[model samples]
Target: MPRTALAPDLSPGEATAPRVQGWCPGALRPMMSGDGLVMRLRPRLARFTREQILGICDAAMRHAAGLIDLTSRANLQVRGVAQADWPALIDIFGGLGLLDEDTGLESRRNLLVAPDWVAGDDTERIATELLARLDELPDLPAKVGFAIDAGAAPRLLDDSADFRIERGAHGGLILRADGRVAGVPLAAGAEVDALIALVRWFADGGGKVSGRMARHPAPLPAWAMGDVAPGPSAGALRSGVHALGVVCALPFGQVRAEDLAQAVRSSGALALRATPWRRVLLEGAAPDAAPRLAPGWPDMDVADLAGWRVEACAGAPFCSQASVETRPLAYRLLELAQQGRLGAQRGAAPAGADTRTVHVSGCAKGCAHPAAAAVCLTGRAGAFDLAFDARPGEPPQTADLGMDAVLARLGVN
Candidate 1:
């Protein structure tokens, strides 16, 4: 394969300026990170067949660095591909039915489907309808997305989305925007039409300037707002078995490609489904199959895996903006949990509380976990700034401490 040409003025891996990109990467248009080109793959209805997953794993090992990241939008991103290998990789992806017709449609089809939806369910139906109408939508910002969370209750409330189709107060459907508390009542089969109208309204009414529906200053039209409120959340999915399948956690939202392929094959799962909570649902897999799927995969009934509670980004050499290597520190935190010293660690939650209390960012951007964590360690100039009960970039409780000093401050031995 031939390499894509870089700018004439800049050599490979050299840039005149440092900046974060606003657009998300896709199969056709990948983002260049410090490690390599990052290509994102979005499966239809957030699912992949067993064969498709196997093909993905094989391709990653041959073309990239064999590393795969499960994104918060319930998508998969293959990291560390060289410029010369992208064309072949894209061909593989297209054969697997993963690519859109073109980059324009690819960028516009940012839909997040409820992972637990069964075939022919309302969630699947709505998502399928919306996907077919992608060409009708006006150009949207790269980050703009839609959520089809019409499960028994909303499951994607915490995930990012601009427009949402969720269950109404009375079990009917409703269309709501990200920032608002209310939603417009939606009739069955009219979900897609309602969504298209809402999107056009946003685009024509100065929403392009704001870039996000939540940040758009214009008030929604009166007809777009109704008294209906979305149903209560079903809550985050954990590493366990459910009626539909087995849910397995991906430590820090990452997995080696071979391990994933092995897990899928071993479980005899008909397909794979992704959730924003760093978990994967093996559709049609037996409830007891989790323990036997793959090594390092968390099975809730077997043993507690502290990696599920921690969020860390690709730090140091993998990311140009990072000054510290984050995963190593994150692993040390896991070691503390194994040593039974986790409770004494600062920001440790009480028993029965949400255990995902730690966030280790490569930089203040907080790309790994956007929500506030009980403890956030932001990298700065080869050291770390510790913040308790806050997000990254907030004033830290303590600043400029080496790793050892940080552990000492946490009262670690």
Candidate 2:
């Protein structure tokens, strides 16, 4: 389901406007928090040097919200920060030499850094260059995405990006366009710029997209190819990721400054990696990690781990524009999925304890996912639209099921 802007644009804004409207409801530019820019971080890169980890924690506490939100994309977002600290943090990022300044190219560059003892130098520089080029992109074709997967840990594999590059390319770096991950040789040092140009060209031609596609999204680029885009991910979510040692949903996808400090202070764990799955991947832990889980700490298993699986946009709390809580709805749908009625009735689930992927959105933004899911619950004023993929080429079979009714229908009291 597609998410609609809070109050229809009455007259929409520019290329980057949707991000503001989509991620944030009312801000024109990124609002500066007290110390850092309130943004999300990707966590696939988990091994932060002890010094780097400590410095990040200190900066996050002093400048930003002191809270970190790990995302499924392996990105990290420090919230509650004031605007003043942004430049300094940006500088700090520069000091760490991890800051890539590509105006308005933030979301466009989901560069995957390898999660090994030593960061891949080429991947790092390439990611920086990609960020610069992505920034130069006036407005990427909505459908285009660019990723430099240095085959990072868990390897940011098969994401919904318009283009992906990795070390194993037939060429120095292969470019996967139009959905396939086949390496298309770039004119050495030309991959990043070529992609920026490609997306710009597509945007000029009218391609509106947020992530990658499983196949060509129609019209031009007949030769492009990419793997099947993954569903809303829960793997990198801090509040939602699988416990490095335990299972728990991170509260609000954030950790208290004190908690973070404690995690950092603990022996052995020397680094932090933020993942799009919304979880913090603590690196350099003691030989035994079982002793590290704080008592009474939230259990990762309690959550509808798949909450991230349903790609719903920020619906209520953060997005005042949203009419409801999309994550919660997605959670409910996942639980209802346990009922296994849809697949069971349709012969889709396994014998028992099956997991059926579902996407629930507060509105239509559908930030969590752009591709279709087995089920989608879109919230509307006074009710919800319960729908499912009846089949491709066929209209979606939908009903006027509101939240309560939908819940009841799902067999959840």
Candidate 3:
């Protein structure tokens, strides 16, 4: 179904603005630490060598917050930082060539390389050079983004990237945006500059496109979705149970700092990738690897077994606009689900086929998803919308139910 912004109590005109920035009257709450200037430490990296990612996880747990967010783009952010420590963190990342603050171009610093590009001969070098140049570009668009992918093997190539740099007919990197190839030709070094220019140009002409890398149904592009991705910018193909597993979030994407820190400390010799999917990818635990440090691994497939889907913004306790605690509702749903009130997979459902996803919103501002879900629960007007996502432009299937009644619909009451 296509996305249409909705705010329960709004007048018709207010429907167009996003619930977060657009409708939430006080969305710009300060996220400052003691020193105050906001925690704005931007890092740069063409690729994460096995060693680098592990070291980063270690440092993140030690210096900043233990939580890492894998953005829709193949990038990571460590939150819970103290403002006074910003400069030092910047220096640490800068020394590793991981942090950059070239304001004019740095804000637009995200780029995803195909995972195959990870093992390719020239891919890493190309990625490194391209990134360095991105930081040096004349201008940066707060909205522009890019990707580099090629003959795909995994589900990741389908990831939506504004500028997808692919192999041109001449063996050069081609720049694509909003799904269309740029009209201009670019040499390898000029690729980064051209990308920056295109993003700035597009941002100037269009409405805000998030730095996220997924496709939104709102806008349509002239170009065909192509086959090529900057490697699986975030996941992998290592063989072993521990080699690859997702860090499952408890329903509405919240994990206690203590639990997260313990996991970080206990990891024996693995690298973690924070995923927008509300989990972490633990690498290096394959068969030939060292033993895991934790008592048990997180059953990454539990949600599928439980046959329930749920997502939410860091509302209430975290965000000021939240009138209700979305995570709590999400967990309650999970509990009812485990008892068989809701459906669970009879056997493991093949990946990507999980039919149910429960989205709980603090207010009407649905920050977690661009469109309505199979079930949309909001705190604002005190209602829940049972949707089918089966139709094109229908306001989600109308079911005005209370929290418990909504739970029972999924057989979870």
Best by lDDT: 1
lDDT of all predictions:
0.79, 0.47, 0.45
Listed per candidate, the RMSD to the true structure in angstroms reads 5.9, 9.9, 10.3
* Residue range 303-322, candidate 1, lDDT tens digits: 25443367787787656678
Candidate 3, run of 10 with poorest lDDT: 21-30
Between candidates 1 and 3, the one scoring higher on lDDT is 1
Model 2 root mean square deviation, Cα atoms: 9.9
Which stretches of candidate 3 lie above 4 Å from their native place? 1-43, 46-68, 77-98, 115-122, 135-140, 150-156, 167-174, 181-255, 274-279, 286-298, 301-309, 315-325, 331-357, 362-374, 378-406, 409-411
Give me the overall lDDT of model 3.
0.45
lDDT of 2 by residue, 43-127 (tens): 2234445566566667777776565554544455655545455556665654654443432344354555433324445566667
TM-score of each model, paired residue for residue: 0.79, 0.51, 0.55
Residue-by-residue lDDT tens digits, candidate 3, 225-306:
3333222233433323432432333334444444444554454434554333444444433433333222233433333436
In terms of lDDT, which candidate is stronger, 2 or 3? 2
